[model samples]
Target: MATVVPPDLELFLTGWLRSNITDVDGLQVGHRTPDGYDGSYPLIVVRDDGGAQSADRVVFDRSVGVNVCGWTRNSPKDCRDLAARVYGLLTGEPDILVGFAEGSSVCAVVPDGCNGPYPVTEDAPYCRYYMTVEYSAAGIRQS
Candidate 1:
């Protein structure tokens, strides 16, 4: 029997991206992968969201869209790289918010039985996503 080598999807894609995007600057990543869930694609939102934060706000300038689909998977490196990019776009700020995202329109891709209308909340829980950056640094109201 021929030995089947497990392919490292993240590593492969990371290498390929690094080799191609030469002009880009610093990058970081944040991931929120769901366990035992299969049906919808993972949400990957990459962008520059770093700036002056307060006791209640966070501002962002630019956000990149990393919509993975058609059998595309994510990795830890992907999360870090995404955060780095967001930082670079905002002048390399370490205080970055790297996590999942979901707007008022889009619903998270979940299982069949556990699927339904998206909840009515501001901080939408995203499973296996990098980010949802803004173009300019803004503030958040943690009130």
Candidate 2:
């Protein structure tokens, strides 16, 4: 069966990331992932990676990943700090409204995997961190 992208994953994740992930000033969240920062420290970019459907094709699950980056000159730990926090907040988060589902509240957000606070460049004065987050919702698709 063909997999269908969850309709509300992006919409729900944008607000979720802004409110829960980017909790500090000078931190910014956007849809596009930048190769370098635009004066925004602790930057988070959310993107729709991929998704899947249940074996019976009734439920949809999607993966939305984020790239968190921070400057690494004076305070060299910000990127990892933000990455750890984002991971903590996302794992096992329940009851998020995935609007495509029929149940009143039927969704869970969890960490799929994680990658560095590794240097963005050998000497670019920045650190890069990435995490793949999975959003799963089981419901009857709206006709």
The most accurate candidate by lDDT is 2
Candidate 1 residue spans exceeding 4 A from truth: 29-143
Quote the positional error of residue 31 for candidate 2 in Å. 1.4
Best by TM-score: 2
| Cα RMSD of predicted structure 2 | 4.9
- TM-scores, all candidates, are 0.23, 0.67
lDDT of 2: 0.60
lDDT of 1 by residue, 1-143 (tens): 33222222233223333443455334222232335334143233222222323333333222323321112233334434443443343222344212211111111211222211121122333223222323332232332
